[model samples]
Target chain A: MAQSADAKAYNAKVYVTLRPSVLDPAGTAVRSGLSHMGYDNVSKVRIGKYIEVELTAESEVAAKSQLDKICDQLLANPVIENYRIEILEAVAV
Target chain B: MAQSADAKAYNAKVYVTLRPSVLDPAGTAVRSGLSHMGYDNVSKVRIGKYIEVELTAESEVAAKSQLDKICDQLLANPVIENYRIEILEAVAV
Candidate 1:
């Protein structure tokens, strides 16, 4: 596969979740709701954000670095939330 | 490895995104934000929900079936949102 080092499209899947030490009241409410719905199997529930970003970069490394900055600046709150990123080459459809 | 068939713990990572046919105004807003922040490399952005549900079930099959119902009834709306589920055994930390 011929690759372009100058400009390549990439897609990023980012998951932002609360740090383990932080309390998630909404999650607790969901757990209680599940219990009320007779879903006794539910033990815990944590809600977070899933973001898909499409961008063009020179390489995977470049894309990753940019995404890290993007997440830190806008996608996630670094103090109480942690973000994970996965990048994939953009395939032409 | 001895495993309990009656009751076992599992964690479900559910990603809820808008259907392809639907428009993501929030994502567009974020993309604009990135552009304004001088990240012009970004082409598109789509924001979605990431739900972490911790539950106990008899088996993977049981866990999946129950989760399908839960997502359909509570976690995700079938009309505009599409949800994907990834289940992993809850490891003791």
Candidate 2:
């Protein structure tokens, strides 16, 4: 079945990062690797996940809400990470 | 030893995403999962890596150049993924 004409497709960019107080072993490993590669000036390496979600909604507001809900509920762990969501341009399906 | 006064610490936000033409099994799996969870409107889910590197450099231009090099050489696979680099505000150590 085809999507409705009123349904707008959006690309959501979600950024999930570790909170300032948490310890990041993966970030430490990456920092060490950079140091070994001669990027000695590099420090405070924090790594995170980037998720791009495409979905169809009635409007941008609805899309934003859904993205926010997903980020808070599934994409990020609120206790240890913070999530930022951006709604990109709407595209045709 | 302390960093020089001229060395400004900047946060680099690197986003690495797979090329649109490439097959994204991880993304497909996530889409399926979302669908199974009742998000039938969700589709085209792409997964990527977000890296935050805090480094001390003389200027924003220099920091951007270094980030470009790192993304091209080590952080991202040029063959399948494209990367974007952003230099954020300088932070005090």
Could you give candidate 1's per-residue lDDT for residues B1-93 as a string of tens digits?
223565778999999999988999999999999999989888889889999998887788988999999999998989999999999988642
Taking all chains together, each candidate's TM-score versus the true structure is 0.91, 0.88
TM-score: which candidate is best? 1
TM-scores of chain B alone in all candidate structures, in the order given: 0.89, 0.90
Q: Kindly give the stretch of ten consecutive residues in candidate 1 chain B with the minimal lDDT sum.
A: B1-10
Best candidate according to lDDT: 1
Error of 2 at A38 (Å): 1.0
Q: Which residue runs does candidate 2 get wrong by more than 4 Å?
A: A1-5, B1-5, B91-93
Tens digits of per-residue lDDT, candidate 1, A1-93, equal 223566888989999999999999998998899889998768889999999999888889988998999999999999999999999999742
Clashes found in each candidate (C-alpha, N, C closer than 3 A): 0, 0
